[model samples]
Target chain A: MPTLPSLRASGGDGADPGRDEVASLTFESVTKRFDDVVAVDALDLEIHDGEFMVLLGPSGCGKTTALRMIAGLEEITEGRLYIGDRVVNDVDPARRDVSMVFQSYALYPHMTVRRNIESPLLVRKYRVDGDGAPPRKLTKAERAARVDEAARVLGLTELLDRKPAALSGGQRQRVALARAFVGRPQAYLMDEPLSNLDAKLRAATRLELVDLHRRVQTTVVYVTHDQVEAMTMADRIAIMSAGRLQQVGTPQEVYDRPANLFVAQFIGTPPMNTLTGTVTTDGGTGPAVDVGHGRVPLPPGLTTRLEEGRPVVVGVRPEHLALSDEGPLEQKVRAVEWLGHECLVFGAIGDSPLVVRQTGLARLEPGGTARLVVDPAHVHVFDPETTERLP
Target chain B: MTAEAVTSPAADRSPEVPRSRRRWLRRYSPREVLLALALLAPSIAVFVVFFYRPFLNLLNWGRFESRRNGAYFEDVGLAQYREALGSDDFREGLWHSVQFVLYTVPAGLVLGVLLAVAAHRRLRGIKVFQAIFSSTLASSTAVTSVIFFYLFNPVVGLIEANWLNDPDMAMVAVSISSIWQNMGLSFVIVLAGLQAVPDEVMEAALLDGYGAVRRLVRITLPLISPVLLFLLVVLVIFGLQAFAQIDIITKGGPVSATETLVFKINRLNRPDNIGIGAVYSIGLFLVTLVVTALQFAILERRVHYAR
Candidate 1:
């Protein structure tokens, strides 16, 4: 595990961790509560070894609570939580072998950058691998070498002597990250660590974070509310709302095949357009949805799940809706926004609003009628009662 | 825009009207300035009568020596100032005042922090404990002195020590009451400081593997150092101005061991010795000002103010 050869010159025999397996975190029906309110209700997520998992959600969602539970900063109010092979429901944060980066970049305001990074190694003793040996601390030289390496990796070497008050926001964030990764903990937990940064800096730091995760090869559980950040950096994104897990999949998988209506509306930029319809079999088609103005075809896989005159929700992405004159659906175009590269055509089919993403500016006028088409393969049907995708 | 518009022409036509008339007339209505001055007049008059006028009289009186029990006075000028300041009584009184400061200020800081840190927690009934810790602020100097005097008396005392009679320990006995009496204010202020520290910083320290003791020393203490410095300055002023505690408890007894500068000034403020008393009062004023200034200059850099 001592892959950093540059640090070996100053301190070779520090308490460096040996080849400990990258630990997988398992939340087995875990729940968290704050007085009468449930922050996380029966969350069962198994983050695999070395996976970059982003817990994506809005504010007041249980994403932060779940990350805190993994750090042992919060108590599990209901069930078992595992770090590696050990059930750490009652373990202290230090013994859990995890480090967290907070949204505030909670740097010690009085300490220099070097001291902040060196503090973890100074306070914690690492366990040697493969045997039942006791934990031992690193020597002073080893501590300095590790701090130097971590600072160099984070590009904070020049700022090692400065207090946090003197550093810029991006530099402070880098210092926070350096302090987190200096100790090769089992897993790194971050609670919206980049939300404090501006947009341009957040974009740049997102790549740096993914690069750091690649070099460390440790499991990183990053929590964020920005879907773009999740789509860019996550190996797997877990979407949550109101203390319940909605879906956990790769970025493209979630955008293409949302398990429910919430995930469908939340994952996209313009949000997926939804229309209410009733399933009817009297038209002699295998399964058809009477979408008020016209009937839209349903996929063959949903044939078993369809019932006559049953209300269902039809969904399609904005980019998938094509403007065809001979199409079945007619909408009254309300407004159009030309975004240089593409134009967003906003319209309404009766009372339900619809948006179409067209490449380049279209010759469309406001307060005019337009015919739109949805590909039969791209149609998504959801049960109006359960709000989950059907078939 | 209105302020600038009024000022630019006043600057361009400097010879016409006095700028004060034009400025006040243009920038503000006469009723506005009149109302502001009306609100400020009472404070200014009271300060002149009660504070500034008496201080000026004391400064002028420090130049002359009283004679024949205030029937006559001799303006010996700087000579009287030199003689009174260079006297052994003044030096001894200053030394005693410094000693009192050394004894009480450090105790006030440490014990205050101990009480504040102990009371500032998340457990049940903590507010009750906080109330008890700050209850000492309710005690008057005389009440505290009586309590300590009885607690240290030889015959009827609880602990029964001879410190009040001993030359060296009498000041320590006096300082104990002051430390106890001033604790409530210190605990309340320091607890406010501890509460103002953001919770995320402490939580981050815990997750960074700092144990309880280490976290307090390394994180909590440094974050509250500004409050500690403010408390230090207040305690120093209180220590220097200590008189009632000494009077009620030691009475400057046991060969005047507990006679701080204020106590000496109080004794000197008689009909015959009023000139020297003014000199000593001025001396105490200078000392207090210098010590408070020195504290801010030396400690402000080390104190961290969180943005």
Candidate 2:
């Protein structure tokens, strides 16, 4: 495989050097509806130029639908979408200048890798005069050069002659990437392109995708159900659930300050332990939430927001819980999972299920009782009815 | 280790000879073998009696020439085969068969693909259109031929065209019936192939800057090539064996322009020309075999079976 330098050189004068500058994408109150069902509801998002933004959600959460809208594959029912500064709501998908890698990779099974990569260029009608002029035909050499450059960038030079059926899943995925890259469109919309690969290959390809993003410097709107992919690869992560945007932030921001109960539970493994509790100032050791197990103290900032006897759902991540001999909460242990570096303790506080992440050689029998303490600052309080965080 | 050591010698010494015999007996047990033979007897008897016996009898009959309406017979051997193949009537019949195949096969394929592509979409009332496309499947070959025969009849046809009268156009008229009758089967098969294509692949093509026509040509067609090839084989066989259409429409008339091999063979199966009829039947079999082999050799190379 010829490296990135050769690819850049072969791009020729026809390649726009200013392509990186014009790749910002924005959705202004975009809503997509299918008959009576809403797939995406008033999604307003801004993906910066050259940013690798990931739409992270569970299946049927409308992340793929949102990405399809950007790719011009799905129509926006109610709002305007802009690629750079131009509204692209009415543009045909072929005219939108965006490429997508589907979850199945969707490599053309009949064509060799070279032909698959060159397909976009082969179909591209050349501009005779200017951007909107009458389209001319591309030369065979031009198509070949573009294909070669894309294949080289993705290290697919040797397998260019092989059909997609002959290639492994990861190689086929890279061919899909190369095909999308050959066009150098304004942005790339990826709908879980790595979901087909096995675990190890998915991880390796995920890293390669990040590297490819760095080299290409194009805005990418990637959708996936995996939070780990979002956490590791995204410059900004947009979390959605039930066709609504829950939060949009850096991975750490969404992890630390989830906007609602959904985000707090969805973003982490073993999820956050939630308990129904009443805020009572009568405990007199600062403000405390009287969960059924005992009263756990609330931080001052959260205390200011709570009224007396206000019912709130308190959320604490598994990592935030500590097993202390003299703690405020008692949990009956149900199971223990030792995961090399850390141990996950599954138990219950009264009737509410609780999971605790204890690091380094912590062992607790399944039938035993353990005292657990949650730091006040780490406790998240949400309104029970709306499931929205307080303050 | 101790159990294996104790059992190893006993296993090796006790069963080595009997094991071979037992294995043979197990593979070919009498009752099981009898059951298998009994199960296969019906199909084997049918093949030998209806298929192979007739073919062998045809070969034997091709060697003997009948005279005076089978009142006398003489063995002529391979000369009869040569004369049957070299006869101008047989050549004309074979040429007519080839012409019929050329007319119907390509028309069947193109129309099948067109109908399948048109109907394989997501639209309101598409099922109704699909049912309309496949409605001809209910009509048998004889019924379709009769319908087309009347439809193309010069005196009372809907269009009153001279299609069935002209020597050059009679075969075309007969082919039209076959193509119409085949439309339903071809449409259904091709539709199945089109449906088997993953929706994501089409969406990917759209995202990759392909328009509707390009997507169909580059993605959908190649993916369904196997189905098309299967349809091709079926259409080719149907074209070669065509009889009812020609029988009903032309009856080998209009200068014998539409007299296919099967029609000639049927005509020659009298008491006076049974030898020639058997020879023509064998020749037609070889021709069909060669045509099918050529089609498979050429078309199967281009087919891409989905993994």
Candidate 3:
């Protein structure tokens, strides 16, 4: 409920409540190229300690590629990777103090749940000294205690004896999470870990993961194509397209003030409507957006910066649109979708169809004409050709 | 109007055909069937001719008895079976066969797994190593036995080892030849299995903090059990049916120390005692069948298939 900048200024108390900085990872100009494809292009970001950061985009957006670079699973073409303080660009994946939960869950199909969890501890003991190969011996008691503790943390005590194949999808994901968290790595890299789960499970696990991040205080960089996952689970969301980062901000920050045209449509439910218009100055009064239907006057103080008669895009969220008896613009309703709490009416404005969200119920029918008005303060303007936000 | 519309021919025809039944043949087109049959036919024909036909002939030949030394003769119906089944010749031959399996199976499995694990990973010039690992497949068992026979020849061999004549080293020499001839196969099979494991699983293991050794013991081996089981079944069969190595290298000689069941059967190919030889052949067949079946029963539970 607090504003982003104010929240940043305040002592750290998030949904789960705490102020301590946990695990942090920094990537400095990380670039990874695979043969002809540039998987990651000049990516620069900081993941705050214990922050649940979601790298969200459509397929081939380089989200997975970025996560792999952080995990030391992929070679970084050009950049510095620091887990806490140490640069691990040359470190082997086995030595990197990071764990990854793959989209497929990647549960070792042959091993029992306990073995899978214990495997990390064994690896740690062998590599922790950083002298030689794995530890040649592990006392049974030490192995048992480690497995027991991890199983308890993941609520998998009863399923320790079961093979990965026998466990349910949710259980398998937990095992994967337990595997990742068993060694208590500095950060967790999850590559669409819940993408394989059913819709209901994904929702439940999303909440669980947020809570887990709070309790563990480990920085997590999660990759997902699902926007809802990004909105609900991430402390900060980084939206990417075509291997380039479009924007990074809190959920509300992204929704209220998207950096570009791409971010405007990428975030929020039902997407924002974009209308091509011309910015014109009338005498010396102010600049006005002329969107074919009618002219909507902009705030006078900000109008002088705008070029006269320049092409621009007026963006408005669906929820900000109001249906009125005597509104300025008229559209014929093409379809209506009734979501339990609200109704969304879709209508055509010239060649483009626009989405409008109305609270409660709507007594609207297909082919009916309605007057639509959007709040001026809630609208965003972008340079039409460049697609950059217009101040 | 609604009643008439409900009785339309299109509506009636829809329910007549079962959707699932229609899908049965449609799932695979004619081209798919042809492709599948084309791939499978050669192996099926070869198994019938080389394996089943010989097996049936051996079974039938085990009947009837005849003169072996020209002074002794009999018309024994399955009498040769009782004689071959109970004779010292059969017992000693069976013992040597078991000894051969003991010598070859474990050595083959361990070496195969070692080589496979070493070469499964991608490294500089790894493809060349992989090709070299499987190069043994080009040499026949006879060729390998001959090579070892000369390598370990007592008086004339280049090495001057006398391995074939020494009682302690005779079985060991035969085992070495068998291992050399068979290591390539086990390596190839296990390597294929290791390669088949999804990269995500290993990454998960590595991230889990499992070093290479723990990962190999806990994750890698178990995941590749199906392949290991396949190697076990194949290598054990090869060990049990070993003959060329004993024949060319030791000739089942030096007091029958290196004689395997197959080698003993080969010696039974005397013209007069065809029936007795048939009995030996049948005995070898039974032994191989029982051992293979027992192995499957025991090892099937240990194999963990991902799907």
Candidate 4:
């Protein structure tokens, strides 16, 4: 083992002698408190190896704090956290073998892109999983080759000599990614890395990040308030609000079956429109919710789980609401937004506003009424008392 | 101008904009430029009367060499400039000034940065320490020199050191006072610079696995190099012009070993050697100008200005 002034991960000669085995990150009953306020409360999650897990929430929902805890930037007030099999509750960030990309890109402005990418390898030891082949420092040539490969991977080869101040926002973002992956650390933690990019570039970079994750195949715990980024890039999305984890599942699963009202409203574009109602037995035809201007049927399977004439809040997504001439619900159209391929018809039932998505042009006008229907399969029922999902 | 003049242009675009209003948008109107000049008139007048006038007089007087202890004079043109500058007295005085700068500048900068970095954290009552560090700025240079003079006194003094009485150590003793006196300004400026560095950059470096020392050397120092360079230029200028400490502490004593260029110039206030004093004064100005210019030329390129 050479002295630790130089280290090379994934050097060309010894590249992938064995595949870089990644580590799963787990948090058990984790809690974080600041002064008097609880920032993250009893967070329990297991982000598996090679998984692209996104922590999705609104701002100040403890998403960034959770990611920082994984990076060892913040202390967990209670509970055990694990990277792989090690309980890294007291481990230093550097020895924990995880890397992070900050929202600001946090590139060393004075160093060239090459040096920025090569910095972690120079300082951190190679393969620090605390087992298998004692950790050793890398040689200089190996470090250089690893930097070259990272630069090539992130399309930063031509910009290696330039400082961060010289790069555009997107280019700086790539430099940040290159720096994070160049060391091949066990896991990568990102906190809203694309929030600074323009909308068009953000969309493009979302795909680029997903592709990078596929190639790198390392565990990623990404934190963001933007659902679009989470939906498009995450293998799983963990939704949080007000310092507590609401639910965690595959993106589609969370989108289709939110565990609570917060997850339902926070996971979709235009969000889920929830109207309060009372469940009725409907002459034993099974339960239905009388949602003010219309009575929408509940899933017949929910009859055994539901009570008669019980108070409930029914949720339906905008895309689930279809415009039908014979539909029972009468929605007074307030506005219509034509989005080329489809249109969003924003209308209301009495006082509750509802958004309905219709294919092609919505030949509807403001101040007119829209007849809309919601399928029972797409309707989500929640317990009005606790705001939790009703089975 | 009308209240909505700026905002109403788009609303009334079809109406032709007056030429003067257009010029104001481009940068400034002629009337505004005149007002700016008028505002600067007082400061310009003061500089001309008190600073530039005396400076020009000194330059002109450098052309003549005094004869017969100011009873007579001889116009030697550039000859006096050459001869007075080349004289051993002038050389020795300039050497002493340079020595004083070398003793004070680096030590002051280092001590300032150390103290600033120490007090820049978020510990409870840290503001008290910051106040203590910057308290030296409250004292006049004479007060600081007098305090040190008594502290280093051989009899009835703090440590009883004889450096002030020894010719070789006299400049070092005086520089000690100067460095202490200049430290407050440096600490305040450097602390401001350190505070301006975004906390996120340091956090990023931490996640990048840089230890504390490497983070300071590689990230912190380079990011604040511009501010450090500014501190250097200011300290260098103050060091070159140093006089009050010398006058109060050692009075250019110990066989005049501590007679810096400024001290010597003041000593030549008599009618006899004012010509030589003018020449040394001009020499000090040129040296300051060149040193500052050299520092900016060499170091400005390395400074990283955050975008």
- Give the number of the best model, judged by DockQ: 4
- Itemize residue pairs with steric clashes in candidate 2: none
Tens-place lDDT digits, model 3, residues B193-222? 889889888887766566778778887898
TM-scores vs. true structure, each candidate = 0.87, 0.91, 0.79, 0.90
Cα lDDT of candidate 3 equals 0.78
True lDDT of residue B41, candidate 1: 98
A32 in model 2: Cα distance from truth in Å?
A: 1.6
In order, the first chain's TM-score in every candidate is: 0.93, 0.93, 0.88, 0.93
lDDT of 2 at A160: 92
Q: Compared with the true structure, what per-residue lDDT tens digits does model 3 show for residues A1-391?
A: 2111111101222332343324578888989898789988988889988789999998999999999998888899998988877888998887776778899888778778987777666645432222244433346785686567667656678789998767777778888887787665667899999888888777767767776775666778999999999999999999998888888899999898888999999988899988887888765235677777655556433443777778888888899888987776677799999998999999977766788999988888999988887677787888777787776
Best of the two (1, 4) by TM-score: 4
lDDT over C-alpha atoms for residue B137 of model 1: 91
Identify the superior model by DockQ, candidate 1 or candidate 3: 3
**Candidate 2, position A85, lDDT:** 93
Candidate 3 Cα errors over 4 Å, as ranges: A1-22, A125-150, A282-286, A296-304, A330-332, A360-369, B1-63, B68-73, B76-79, B85-88, B99-103, B122-181, B243-259
Which pairs clash in model 1?
Answer: none
Ranking by TM-score: 2, 4, 1, 3
Q: DockQ rank, highest first?
A: 4, 2, 3, 1
True contacts kept of 3: 0.50
lDDT of 1 by residue, A219-330 (tens): 8999999999999999999999999999999999999878899999999889999999998876544567888876667865565567689899989898988888988789
A218, model 2: CA deviation in Å? 1.0
Native contacts present in each candidate (fraction): 0.42, 0.46, 0.50, 0.49
Greater DockQ among 1 and 2 belongs to 2
Decide which is better by DockQ, 2 or 4.
4
